[model samples]
Target: MKKSYRIKANKEFQHVFKHGKSFANRQLVLYYIKKPEQTHFRIGLSVGKKIGNAVTRNRIKRYLREAFHELEAGVEPGYDIVIIARQPTKRMNYHEMKKSLIHLLSKEKLLSKK
Candidate 1:
């Protein structure tokens, strides 16, 4: 993911967790806060050890990045978005993960009407 699009700071992640609205499913939890002052988005992903080893966790992040890339056009901008992978997410394939991500984002009304 591009540096501009990824949310890399601890403080930013905390801000999202503290202030964002959340939505979840078996595979993922999404937290999002709208930042009207901004013109773009910052996204973060969390795939902890509870889900898997480093390799497994990295795989999840990779898949999520790709999924987000694919859906980026449809997503509304100006939000800080965080995606935390759940235990079940460790075993899912890219398509499943993509679907889960979209579902969660859709629930947040983050996906555009198109």
Candidate 2:
């Protein structure tokens, strides 16, 4: 994903966590807040050390970023979305990870109808 499409600041992530609504599945947790002024969505990915070593954590982040990129056009614009990987994600492949993400986003109606 592009830098402009990511939430890199701790403050921004915290703001979304504190003020946003969230939804989750066994593999991933999602927190999101609407930012109507923006024209596109931004995302923050968090993979805890508890999940694995650097390589494992990085792989999870990569999968998430790709999943979000694929779902970009269908996601509701103007939202700050943060996804935290769960223990289950360490064993999941890209397609499984994407399925889990889609489940969470759709549960909260964050995916656009189109």
Candidate 3:
């Protein structure tokens, strides 16, 4: 995913968390806030230390970024989204993680009908 489509700043993540609505599945929690002026969606990801070691956490992040990239076309634009991986994700593969994320986004109507 491109840097422009990522939520990098701590302040940005805080804004999304504080103002956004949330949804979750067993493996992930999603927070989102709409920004109508934005041309595309932006994402932030969090994988807590309690979930795993550094390598495992990094792997989870990579899977999430790739999933978002692949789902970019169908996801609603003009929103800032934050995803927090849960303990169950530590044992998941990329496909499973993607599926879990899709479930959360779909619940909130963030993934556009395709």
**By TM-score, who's the top model here?**
3
61-104 per-residue lDDT for model 1 (tens digits):
99999998888788898999999999998789999999998898
Error of 3 at 82 (Å): 0.2
For model 3, name the residue pairs that clash.
Answer: none
lDDT of 2: 0.93
Q: Which candidate is the best by lDDT?
A: 3
Report the alpha-carbon TM-score of model 2 versus the true structure: 0.97
Q: Assess candidate 3 and give its TM-score to the true structure.
A: 0.98
**How would you encode candidate 2's per-residue C-alpha lDDT over 31-78 as one tens digit per residue?**
999999999999999999999999999999999999989999999999
Q: Each model's TM-score, in the order given?
A: 0.96, 0.97, 0.98
> Model 2 clash pairs?
none
Rank the candidate models, highest lDDT first.
3, 2, 1
Give the range where candidate 3 is weakest over 10 consecutive residues by summed lDDT: 98-107
User: What is every candidate's alpha-carbon RMSD to the true fold?
Assistant: 0.8, 0.7, 0.6
